[model samples]
Target: MGLRGRWGGRAAIALCVGAGVWLLVTALRDGWGRADPVASVFGSVAGLAALVLALRAIPAPRPPVPRPVPPEVPEWWVDRDEADAVVRAVRRRTRRWRSGGSVAITAGLHGAGGFGKTTLAKYVAAQRSVQRRFPGGVHLVTIGRDVRGPAAVAAKVAEETRLITGDTVETGSDPERAGNHLGSLLAQRPRTLLVIDDVWEHEQLAPFLRGAPHSCVRLVTTRKT
Candidate 1:
């Protein structure tokens, strides 16, 4: 609560407490009146109200901020027109989020083996323009080409989240539910780009999904078309 709110709550408690005491004093001075059947009950409620107000005056602790690391800019970035194209697409999507315009939730690179898909994805994330678009920071988590169950996926989400933010995510064996929980965590960080690289199946990306279609975009690099 702000200064005004804390003082306002204190005032309310004082008023309620005073009102209750006044009622009791009035009953004692004038015997039990016909309409004064609930003097004790009203006083008890006033005490409870004061307690609640006091609790409300104290603010809750804030969650720890994530410490994200963007991919290091390549020392000698070579001729990769493909990498620039992907960066432009991501820039467009992030702009839509900034403009309050509708945008797709997921976008990334996909290509055959030895085609530099991971390189392009990392390059895009390392770009200055892309980094600026995603103020929350770009977090890269690689899910290599292999089959993984729901539990495995959830564990990955928790591990990466903890690594990036030091916030522990409660993940279950269910990918859908776990995704929702992780998504809520990511939702706290709007405009973040979560890159899940070397994906084999769509299910591999499920654990990283946000509960709502908010500003956080899930970018994946895959061999699949």
Candidate 2:
């Protein structure tokens, strides 16, 4: 008939075959005609009860969900109120940092380079509330030897912003141009958090922090005062 009907018929045949095999085995082991039917039934019932108890004792493994990519966003593993407060504080700090005046988030993060500043920044950026606040999305730039000048900073920011610096803005053309372009980008957004990690000098903080637009926030994670 149908595939489902065929499967059902096959299953029925398989079950019947299994039962017949079990009966034949039982008869061979205990002389079926000579054995007491009641005793046999009671033994079978007891065996089934033991089997069920054993099955219940064993723990079943949870099934895995197949997906193309795992979610990168952090699930709320903490209390809702605490999470909401953290998000609000972040947004508020973002606003304060973006303001014309210099604002510093001075928390004593122990250790040197190996300290978890970058990780914490990333986690904060990935927060659902922060993500919602900045629909333009978050950009992370790591400053190093290759990233010595303003041009490199612009290039990194452009990359983070998901735009080619040459095609969209000329931050890489010159230091002043790069600074202006970066500032403009930061200012253009309604709410953006610009994080500068592992700073070595007070001068390094000046360009990115100074004269930035009120729209975006600048967050610096530095070792020095």
Candidate 3:
């Protein structure tokens, strides 16, 4: 709660408590046995109001709100020609799959840390041609060294894809089940583009690759070749 809200609640509670105490004291001083019925009733009401106010003064927990996912498009991109070149290359390599073939296309963009590999991948994924080709939509997952392991990576992808049916794959502990579930979901889709970014090891890509559709195009970005 804000400062204003807290102060307001405290003031309300104080007023109620003070009123209740004053009424009880007045009733006792006048001798409750001889007190008027109206005085007794006022005292009871004031005490109840004070008790309710005190209870309300205690804070209740707020429910958690889901965070909004960031958009795939970059805020500002430099070197449009470079991004276009990479996009064209990706399209050329994956063109065979668009012709009713079941070949899975994989491309790696390896460079130094700040070389904008992820940005380029986002640009490619956002292309009209790419979107038109993959009707299932483009999904991006970040699996850096900080990511626990294959299981964690799988769980993250599953969450991003909204594939969590129950507690089967919470926190990505069951990689096999998560991978299989994800794969089954993707297999049902016609085509999809999976962009795996900031990968630190080749092994981290296994679970995601296992679930990807045969006609899907996988774009990987990493500092290592």
Candidate 4:
């Protein structure tokens, strides 16, 4: 029931309990010789009924448990050996950079629109190996046609990451500032994977490219090389 209903029910229960107590007390005050057995029995029943009502009126509240966030990847992905090969190659390249002590590594999957570049990037980002490498998290950001300039892209990334709660970073208009805020949040972790999908131009990717630590790896999917 809603809060109002629950409170109303409790109030009614309290009245019933008070009435029952009064009835029991009055019955006990009267002498047995002058008391009506029916009245006494009714009083006893009322007291019992009050006890039951009080028990049902209040309930213990339970604490909520937070659920784990699910990965952003396609279900029922069909087998594409060629696409898988490219994902593996990119993964290896990122791993090599990490081993070589590179601060940050950026790789791109460039191809025409219909060739499934975004799909391939998703597949790579969702891979078990990639998940293991980036313990911080794997975030995917799509650059739509309307998402012009770096600041807008940074805002989208901030919204997707949810690094800061409330109006901080996400509501900002400055792309450079938003990117710096996002980078600072990501830098707290040892490593993270950022998947930029359907990027049309280099400028669209520039703002987000800043602030990421060397351990962070960026995988971009675009039509441009």
Candidate 5:
């Protein structure tokens, strides 16, 4: 069926032909001159038929198919071994956290942004179990940029998450409306994780996060206490 298979099939036929010719020569040389001609011909035919059948029955090589797209595996934080264990734990605990509880992970060389917070958060988001927890898909937004205000942040998150915010959002919609729309979107999805990276202060981002649940865990990477 494939290139390799075709080549193999041709090679097998060549080998069978060579073997049949060698046997015929051997039979003639080893006193087949005294044997019955009809029986000799029938025997040769039967042997060749069986050899061909056996060769044809041999398995053919199948062509390799393209690989499936893998779910994102995050950049490792700390040692690779440690990250694997932590990611497994995070994946396991999403259900518990979404049930109105919280789970906090503090690792790496320091607290907040220095502690590989973003890396771990991404790992959690990418986990198969974690992805299942949020049907709407996890959204990661970096704050403290030019997009500082609540409205700007909402619009940015909506756009980043590929949520359909009408064209009017880019033209003149206020930040509150954008925030409200984002909140509504989160509400529609039963469980979601929104990581607000590099938060200068919790209060600054809180307004935009109003409709999102406590169950909808927010991973914050910040220097502030």
Candidate 6:
């Protein structure tokens, strides 16, 4: 119930309880004697009725709201502890103070192919705690080996931006320009987590890394050392 209704209910309950107590006291003073037998009986009954009304005026408790749950990992995945450790390290790094304010926290997972680096990145991003910090959401984009051209990389970045924001993006053959555009979109969202997967070279990553804002944390996965 609303504030007014709640107060109103409480007031009514108090009034009923007071009335019941007064009636009971008066009935007890009469002692159910012949002096006023009818009044004593009537007061006792009215007291009980008022008490019942008081009890009925109490409000029922509301049910508890459920908390948000993280998405479950794949059944075949077994590196849960590694994913959790990555999450902790990322969070700890984010909490550290930076002179220029919140600095860009870019976490890289580099290893040979088939080592589950991308899988761990996904698992870490899907965590409920990570989502709480990065409410803008974790946007993942794959920059595979074939996507080396400026136009292709730009298109991939724009496509990923469009996928997440649902807003139309205008991109060109300039990789830096496209990354800057995507960065602007990410900045609009508070504490965004951008996962650029399967990065192959410095040329492929520099644009995205340079353009991303301090609020956006980059989790890049690359097979190349």
CA lDDT, every prediction? 0.76, 0.52, 0.67, 0.66, 0.55, 0.70
lDDT of 1 by residue, 97-197 (tens): 66787777888677898897877788888888888888878888888855487778777777777765566757667777777777777777657777889
lDDT of 5 by residue, 80-186 (tens): 46556655654444655547565553222115545666666666666676667655455666666466665666566556434322223342235555566566655
Worst 10 residues of 5 by lDDT: 163-172
User: Please, what are the lDDT tens digits per residue for candidate 3 over residues 118-175?
Assistant: 8888878777877776666666777788767766666676675563222233535666
Could you tell me every candidate's TM-score relative to the true structure? 0.73, 0.47, 0.57, 0.57, 0.47, 0.62
Clashing pairs in 1: none
List the candidate 2 regions with Cα displacement exceeding 4 Å. 1-88, 94-111, 149-167, 171-173, 202-204, 210-212
Per-residue lDDT for 1-225 in model 6, tens only?
556556656666666566556656666876535336555565566566655655665666534323224446778878656687789876655566344656546788899999998889878877778878766666777788988788887777667767756656577778888778877776665666677899998778876775545667788899987
Clashing pairs in 2: none
RMSD of each: 6.6, 20.1, 13.7, 12.0, 17.9, 14.4
Residues 25-86 of candidate 4: C-alpha lDDT, one tens digit per residue: 66688754435564566656666765665566666553432222435567777767766776
- The per-prediction tally of clashing pairs is 0, 0, 1, 3, 1, 0
- The stretch of ten residues in a row with the least summed lDDT in candidate 1 is 34-43
Residue runs of model 6 more than 4 Å from their true location after superposition: 1-71, 97-104
Error of 1 at 182 (Å): 1.5
What order do you get sorting by lDDT, best first?
Answer: 1, 6, 3, 4, 5, 2
Residue 6 in candidate 4, Cα distance off native in Å: 44
Give per-residue CA lDDT, model 2, range 107-208, as digits (tens): 222236756555565566667777776544444444444456555555555554333112354345344455566676556545655556666655445556
- Per-residue lDDT value at 218 in model 3: 77
Question: Candidate 4: lDDT over CA atoms?
Answer: 0.66
Ranking by TM-score: 1, 6, 4, 3, 2, 5
